[model samples]
Target chain A: MRPAVRQKLKRRFAETLDLPPSVVLDQAVIHIFGDSEVKIVNHKGLVQYSTACVKTRAVQGLIEVGGSELEIAFFSAQEIKIRGRIRQVMLK
Target chain B: MTQLLWLWWQGYLTVRLRGAGIERLLNRASQVGVALFRVERLTSDVVLVRMAARDFRLLRPLLREAVNGPRISVSVLDRHGLPFVLRRFRRRSFLGVGLGLAVLAVFYLANFVWFVQVFGNQALAVEAIKTAVEDAGLRMGIPRSSLDPARIERKLLESLPDLVWVQVKNRGVRVEVHVVERDEAESGEQRAGHIYAKQDGLVTELLVLQGTAQIREGDTVRKDDLLISGMYYDHQGRRQYGAARGIVKARVWYEAVGEASLVRWEPLRTGRRRSRYLLTVGPLTVPIGRSLPRENHLVTSRTWQLYLGTAMAPVSWTRLDYEEVEWETVPVPAAEAEQNAYELAWESLLAQGVDRERVLVEKRAVENLADGNGIRVTVRVEVLEDIGRFSGQ
Candidate 1:
């Protein structure tokens, strides 16, 4: 019922089952193509959007992107594509 | 590829989203599976978003809560998708009817022959084949279905004795008539009797194939002179007539005479020219200039037209250029004119099929005209040729 207890029990169960943490823990998979495009799979939702910046929610933290003319090229329930002059990407 | 076309057919709209909670709107849109794309900030409080036009309808009810504080204004910047375009045509029902009638008319006109082309036919005139085609009811503007090509081919082959083969092909609105003409004379070249000089020349080489050589090398011969005799002498001093065959190579001279006045005319610009611009849409031509140019000037035009795929569209642009030319009299140099006359003579000599490889330049002569005003250049070309002929005895 507690947050630490649930996490410890899930880690023990994952170790016993020999399952990868990314799939078992619902971790987001991020892929970058060149310097202008970023594809984040398993994204939760869009947080903030602007021409200079975009923020999306990942499993562990929030994905913050700084760019010029940033645009959501495409998006669905599973993956989201951000395309433009992507300068920096950080998880905060 | 089909999905991309489907996206276009379903139509996409760039909606200007204006609200303080634009992020919340996007999150909610994605959560509800509306599938928004190409979202970018247009202004401080406004964001331009591209999404399916059909999906925008699902967001209308959700935006009702912010109607007073942050109202949304929707404007159709550009309309895409087939149905939206079709809806515009539906409003103008006459356009649909006119288009349908035009298509039907074009389809009807396609069944008739617009042009007829003849190919691979010699000896038998193209005019004759066209006449034969018309006789078979395959003339211009005739319906294609009324006559058969095979029947026409058969009838043409039967009517024209020279046609060895005939083919009638229907290409679009044009009909192509192909025919092969049969040879009339069989081995006519081998049967000959008299052997005469084809031109005036000095004999350079001579060979008798089946007759007596009448002229020897270095001997001058005139046109129509007997170069080879068609008669052979027997031991009893009697003459026998037969086909005379021989090869006689000779030096043939070609001469051309030309005269020109002391004064010549040269063309110069008059400095007064006119030009105009025109645009055409379909068959309608529209003038886009002050006025047409003056008369007596040459008119040339350059046109650019829009061709979509293989079909030429109605839109076109054209520019016309005009120039005024005036001829002025000038004095001519006698030596240059004489040289030009010599060049012209040489060209004419080559054009007469004179052998250029063995031209006897030493025998060439430049003759003065009797009037003492012009010059004539004669070119003597010595050629080793097969001058053979079968003279019947």
Candidate 2:
């Protein structure tokens, strides 16, 4: 990605996440697994982690996980952190 | 940029770190008797501490502890404030202040005259002399160091001829002036043109000089008789008068008997030196010196000084005088006692103007008797001498 586009997306993501924009995500390093745990590390230390075993889906304005409940207010972000049993995974 | 970097390095890092090091150094310094306190940060790395120099020296070794790496440095700044700095060099000793005051007091007292007096005559006006003295720079409140008393006295005598002698004495702050007035002559030079016999007797001898004789030898002349006339005729035989003065001596007779106590008291002089200063003010005199060195003694005479009309200084020189007291005793040889009485009678007659050539001892007798005080002696003497004389008539 271009540096400018990356900076704009980082700002928009920080605004959507309600975190300070001054927070540097550039030093952040991400780890992903197809059906395993997810982890993120920044220059300072570990920032986030998740373990999953659940069915996931993303619709136009909502996301559902294993049809346990449909909570529209909980649907947010391109990258989601999950911590539960994963039945399936879907990306819109 | 390099300069700015150097400044930031030196000013900010080195200086500030050195200041911070001062407190730790002082803390280590005060392990002895000194104490450092009230440290405050002046810069990011700079700190100032107040402590005594002894403590600072004691902590000198710990100052190096603050120099850890090349980036850090240490330095020490004296904590004496502005007021202490201003007063540090201006202290004076108490002795110096006291000496200065004493000198000033002496100088002031030296200029003030403490006493003034005028001496010698009572007729001379004291106030007038005082005024003259003041005009001559010898007044009160004038320093003795600057006054010349002799010159003042000379000037005073120059203007007042009535003063025969003048003297001025200065002792410390007191001044004394002595004056003596001139004496007038006696008035008795107006007897002339007459001559009279001094006594009533027959003249035994006569001697004439520059006068007319009215009586000659063997002439029976009464008292007040004109023995010589001063009036004489000139070349024209006219009467001319002059002073009548002559001396006549004639034989006279007298007898005296006196009794003397064999024992008599006489004063003996003892040589001793005693010094005293006499102060005189006008007619008044006061003795400022010692009265007597010996307590149980008699004073025969004393001398004093006058200033103005009063005595301000008194100096007395006293000597021991012994007085012989007479006492009664048993009678001794009458011959010696009679001789002593004769000598005493001769002395007495001589003092009474008995002519030495004609004086004669007729009878010598002494009766020794006991008296309350001493032995007594009685004697008689006969004296024959010419006792007639004539003065100006």
Candidate 3:
């Protein structure tokens, strides 16, 4: 979906249910703990998996995760959890 | 933790997946709803993963998805959980059946009598009672359920009319029969009888239960003398005869003399020793050597044996202890010798049936021997007790 249209639908959906847009939206919610880990929820699937880097397909675009010793702490259709010395998380 | 438990509960398989796209095996397995976990990358072209045992069959067709030949070899590593254990054990069904049959056999055998015991019966013969019990179908090796305790007791009372009271106790695998026999002669009709003195003693108390008292308190009586007369004067001044029953208590006095030598000999160990060992095999004792200890040495043996339950092994180790002892003459003081003689006199008094309890009084005397070679001690103890006996006129 287009970014503008996706934003409008999320806002409307959140307003209709009286809930937070972050919860209603299908966009990847990234949680970064300093340099230790970055957990991405609401993802599509694992596109590339390696020890040094990982590329996950988020609901919006390609989610490139760069870090040292990156391990898939957890992997499922809805969530992709990467742990270990995460240096950067880019969504392009 | 939950993953390990799930693997154990559902049964898992360890397989070696060799290919450049080995990682894809995990992805493809997960896609096929196989739930592969614990993936470890062993090499660039090989990986190991655990999947459900049931999923091993589905992975064969998916081998075509690998980059290389994708050779997969699966060996059953382990089978866990109660269901898998039962499945393996089910192959030998006789073990289960045998265990069940053994339990049932124990239950069935416990209901039958294996041993019968008799108690509290003195005058009644145990063998006669056992025969009667056999007649009642409650003997050894009989079913307890078929025997009624009350009916057996009644049968015993009928067979042996002398039983005043009878009790039957049936326990697991054992039956106990207890009976109290009646004293038919004492309670039945009897002719006249006299109460005589069983021994010489001074009468302390006397009571005639069914006859006239021939002797009163404080009277000295000899053995076989009459204490109660079965012959009594009737109301019309005529002689009559009946059984005599009474209690006669007396204070009996006794004396004993003991002598102790002033110059006596006692055996003392000289500290000289010898030792030997012997082995016993099944009641046959074999000495280790023919060497024996010197003369005048007393030999004592100590043995050690191993036992398992009630059975003892035939192998026994015995060690003999020998010590040389010599009898030496020792001069004993007169006072000590007199004390020793006094103890000997007391022992002799006890041997004559003197009552240790209720001794009214006691006296002792020590005197030098007439030849002046030894000492003599005398002891006398008095006790009050019953001394009545039954006799016929």
Question: TM-score of every model?
Answer: 0.59, 0.31, 0.41
Residue B373 shift from truth in candidate 3, angstroms:
26
Q: Largest DockQ belongs to which candidate?
A: 1
lDDT: which candidate is best?
3
- What local lDDT does model 3 show for residue B172? 60
Listed models, DockQ each: 0.49, 0.00, 0.08
* Per-residue accuracy of model 1 over B221-332 as CA lDDT, tens digit each: 8877888887787679788766676788876665544444445767677777677899875456999865644444566889996554443344569988877776787876
Candidate 2 ranges with C-alpha deviation above 4 Å: A1-92, B1-202, B219-226, B245-247, B262-313, B317-332, B355-393
- Per-residue accuracy of model 2 over B1-393 as CA lDDT, tens digit each: 553333233332112234333323432343334433333345445544444333344454555554572233445544344333334433644655676785565445545466788877777789887777777778767766777877887888887777778888866556788888765311223455556665455566666554566776677666677777776666798887765444444433444444455444343435454555454432345665566634333345544332223323222233333222333345534555556666676677676666667645555555555564323444444443222333454
lDDT of 1 by residue, A4-28 (tens): 6876777778888998766766778
Cα misplacement distance, residue A11 of candidate 2 (Å) = 99
Put down candidate 2 lDDT per residue, A1-92, tens digits, no spaces: 99778878887898899986546444333344453333222212111111222222221212223322211111111233333333443322
Q: Which residue pairs collide, candidate 1?
A: B192-B390, B192-B391, B192-B392, B193-B391, B193-B392, B241-B393, B242-B392, B242-B393, B243-B391, B244-B391
By descending TM-score, how would the candidates be arranged? 1, 3, 2
